[model samples]
Target: MKKLSSLGLLFLLILFLSGVSQIAFAAENPQYGGTLHLSNDADWDTLDPAYASGFDAGEMAVKFYDGLVRFDFSSNKIVADLAESWEVKNNNQNFIFHLRKGVKFHNGVEFTAQDVKYTFERLYDPEVASPGTWVYPMIKGTAAKLAGESAELAGVKVIDDYTIEFDLSEPFGLFLTHLTLPYGLIVNQSAVEKYGADFSQHPVGTGPFKFVEWEHDNKLVMKANQDYWAGRPYVDQVIYRVIPQPLTDIAEFEANNLDRTVVPEEERERWLNDPEWSDYITTIADLSTYYLALNSDFEPLDNPQVREAINYAIDSKTITDSLFPYYVAANDAIPEGMPGGSDLPIKADPEKAKQLLTEAGYPDGFELDIWVSDSSTSVRVGGVLQALLGRVGIQVNLIKNDWSVFYNTVKNGNAPAYYLSWWADYADPYNFLNALYTTDRIPFNNQEINSLLKEMTITTDTDQRIRLSQQIIKLADQVGDPYIYLYHTSTSYVKHPWVKGDLYHQMYTADKLLTWWIDQDLKAESTN
Candidate 1:
């Protein structure tokens, strides 16, 4: 009997050890030769970053293109991406860049200075009609030609095969930051010469990922570029699916088929309470301002009292609470978290709104129409706003449009006192305030705004420039330029529990993909 018992005990102990080992292995971040999935609010149906105006397209661009300079998310300063280093001289009039020595385009051709010159010249070219054309006009003929008013770009010059130079027409603080944008992404002269119009369907760049193929409104695949100058990207593949509806995104993500998604406000509570959701719901206060852009140059918006009444009548807190409980209120036109962001003023006085309305000749209130996108976030807020304004005697007719179609229509300076939001493309306040308001030229700018923009652009002192920016925000408040004040919004995402690296918010227009990687079990173990 004693011998039998000893044999049984030995067997039990061996089984226990085997089970413990399995448990330890199961808790690790599993890495496989697989795809990392991401979903967006809508399908940004373009592969060419130059013509892809929306940020949705911008997000995928880091996988397909390279820029002259990249922003260091940690420092919010300029760093090298394609060009190894650069110097600003000629008394701040010229910027000369030295390209990386051995960078190769996907086509197997060496990337050179000619590509940089071509990028700027194309933006101003009549055929490209690039959305970023307005921001680069100082490069000489680029602006006038892009606006269809001229035929040549002036300031861009190729110093040599590895050197590129630009002469700024004036002291524009955000020019370098703008160059780091998707518009500034360099494509191989060889690739363009090879692909022609089909380049939109297929592109090659000195980026971390290379284009595989686009299956239309289904899937877009990008495989790791093994020969990447930075080093091979950690994820093997990145797959993007065109799940247009927000609910579809949530459903697909919950099914473990996707890695990340943009959660709209309507479903916020439901998703927050779900058992399947662990840490996946991501919410961050987007460095954006949600406000109504009044065509102050025309219509009811031209009336200062009309604009002020609309502003005062808005209960930014209530709408934000009912829809996005995770958001903050807008104190000014400029969003928070950038230089000079705090200088903007804040207040919500109904009496002040009423007084402005009365002074503008409408003691009995007025009728107005407001346009907004039909996404859950935009629609929910628009609904709440419509009701709020109704209470204050401003009967606003709300119009909801498709996102792309909506932007195209409203951007023509005919935007009908619509609800829209703006995010800064770079680190500086100049990018935030000046770009939209200073353009009193093409679409036309207000004289006051144009003059203020000129002063802000020329000022060299950092502190003085910030003060001038504050003055611009103050001026915007006094006038009803961007007429509505909604709440400041927040966004949060669940990051698969293993992804690591800098999640940059001010990535010009997109997040960096090169540094991000999955935590393979070999390196670290997961608690779950």
Candidate 2:
């Protein structure tokens, strides 16, 4: 009887070991199904890629749409998306793209070269009024299209059902980078015509996720596309909840209600010290620049001395210290680590600021209206600026508006002075210089700077392009002083350990939602 009992015990032990092995294997391998809960501080302005001007809209746009090419996170180089391959011809003035076969839009319509032609023509349509039109003006015949003289983009041609071509008016060295912008994303012509003006609400595209629903200020949900040209997303669904308050999002993350969230400035240290949470935290020095934009067309700001005084009044070092570890004080228009970025002689000198203000005919400091988004962080920064500018005799009247209103106001160059940040659309320094200092966006212009910018666009040599970028920055600083350079921002987020395959990219305009998945068993074990 004792021998029999020993044999039975051995059999039970073997079964136990087998169960343990199965569980271990499941934990290590990629799982196929789960949900990822994410948060956005505000509702996206629009899902229409053509008019998606803000970060919120961009976050959602890339998931539902795709462009001809996109930035590969691993290489930080342009890679094909819808297009299988492309060729630069005619001295870089003419280009051709070979589209992937059998790709279908969300509505089940097969994609073709015609769709590509329609997308670009719609973008150049005056009725669209896309802010991104500037990115493609180098295309031949855009002038006639913009003026309503032509309904078609004369430069864009459909070579066949599987191929398309673009003829540029000039050789734009950064043209591929231009195609990587969200605005360059392709759309189905039938979908746009069906939805008409309400297309923003009903977006259709050939991407990894399909739009399920958007509950206004509450949450936006997307489901994986089973027919995605690339394999379907690991997560079954992606939920982006609009939690405007940072603290609230953090609380949700801690309570296991969220998969990941941005760690608030006040909570960063605490999260880093926690044994369990610290492992989940990821940080990246973002390719973004935060600054105070003084409208050069507006009142005293039109005076360079006044702009210089405003720059001198703000103690950037102090501000950088207050947000220590999250931001680095910006010394030039370009973000640190980017090519051509350098620290100029600019620094905070209260005395110098006072002298400049006096020289600009505002000895006692004058009242100025500064516009900012209603986000808590923006408001806090605005208050800090108001205090600093007050020290140099500028009374700042803080005007806070929701992101949509604030984005439009500043984008239209209506705000006298505004606290804003420019996130990198592409890694090139010209992206920053051309977008911020050009007369098209900001009210400041110097013929020398403008000429250098135009030259930088076509300069193919990396070194020569960098040299031109630096020259433009120096000239803009000495002459235009269009913006008060503040600091470059960082991205920090604490994610649950079970949330896997996420990356904190330097240019994280779009999160790689398709690659991410949740380990349900591990999450349950950890939460419990």
Candidate 3:
């Protein structure tokens, strides 16, 4: 044989790895039957779709509920779920959905257009006070209903048993994408009536899996729905073990007691380098951003120079490098990989930050209290900020609280400064810009940016929408320095070799759990 050149050797290595990956993937032939053991640091707050907010609850919602449309991970597009097809007319203000035939809820209730109407009406109901109500402002008469002026939303209409229509007050381009979120998950009307306020405990929906049990801080169990329209789930059951500590979860995963769990930051590199464990790790850049939110209404933070100085004091890259190996430093409020996102020229400049503080009448710096959750990541980030801001002569006091208490304090605007992360509810720039900046939760505001955001929602032209989004981001970066952009997160999870399916989703983390299965032979070998 002729001597192979260096390039030929590299090509051969690539070919070998590619073939190995394919063989490894194909080895587990989509078998059915087995319980998937998973873990979460926090327990779910609620399983009711109307009130599901956190990642834990959202994960459960994905298995126990079905929305009109769902995001297709393969195509990265909005595809049909319960609603098989849809049509838009009247300049995007009107929408008609043709429901999938013979779909049944977990309780065997036939899914229909009436269920769709009921779900939205409940969302818009003032008494319900669902957090999901934010998603329905575009629908006609929703504002009036929310304000107690009307009892019904004039937009949702049951055209027939298998069809429904929506009339928006104006054109909203993200309407379809919004329907893919938990808020749009349809519920059986009878179940809601039967369960009432306790529906969160006894949730019923049309999905691949049905709720089996939830033992508060222990575990949540779900079983496959044999009558599911999509098809019966591959896994027979899913048990989410509530392990509060990441280290504990990792320990369980290593012991084979847990099928999958998040790999702790301390062990990430070691696991990646170990050939025995490398193939089990899966990492994906999450569509999310973390930031230090300054209550712009507060004294020092109200000053533009002070806000800018705070942004300049902390080095986001250094923080990410030390504390979060999987995260990328974010300079712009909008995360990277999204359209219209651009990085700001913000970096650590302690001297400039001090000068800006002096200019804002705080020559000796000022004392600021930062409220953060008790999560490992939050505590580390808070400690880093405390140290960095101290270098600029700012005295920082970190107040740590449980997740629920911390979230309530920040959401109520009681915290002068807080650390939080916003994950995209839908894959749209508007969700990031409008939800974080324009909302009353944060004190940032600019009439031009707000107007542009509103116009962007109505604008159908892609180029015009992109331009408007870019303008909004630029204006927010210049004026509304309410948040110090930190970093975008990359999430990693370790799965046993027997676990098989699409496990990563940019938006919905656990949505693909229904499709995952365990190889009987591989699992048996691991146990032996």
Report backbone clashes per prediction.
18, 1, 0
What's the C-alpha lDDT at position 297 in model 3? 76
Worst 10 residues of 3 by lDDT: 1-10
User: For every model shown, what is its TM-score relative to the native structure?
Assistant: 0.83, 0.85, 0.89
The sequence of per-residue lDDT tens digits that candidate 2 reaches over residues 362-415 is 999899999999987899889889999999889999999999999898888789
Q: Which stretches of candidate 3 lie over 4 Å from their true place?
A: 1-28, 147-151, 358-364, 373-376, 399-409, 460-466, 509-512
* Cα lDDT tens digits for candidate 1, 19-99: 453455346533444467776556666668678676767767767788998776444566788988888876556788999
RMSD of each: 11.6, 11.1, 5.9
Better of 2 and 3 by TM-score: 3
Decoy 3 TM-score against native = 0.89
Give lDDT: candidate 2, residue 109: 98
Q: Give the candidate order by descending lDDT.
A: 2, 3, 1
Give the clash count for model 2. 1
Model 3 per-residue lDDT tens digits across residues 1-528:
112223233334433454464466568568889899988888889989999877667767978888888887443468888889999998889999999999988888898999999999988888989998888788998989888898778999988999999999989988988888788889888999999889999989988888889999999988999888888988899888899988888888889999987877678788778899888877665678899999977887888889889988989988987887656787766655556565456568999899989988999999999999998778989999999999999999999999999998888889999999888887677888888877677667688887998887886666786677778767766784788889887656788888877446567723746567888898999889
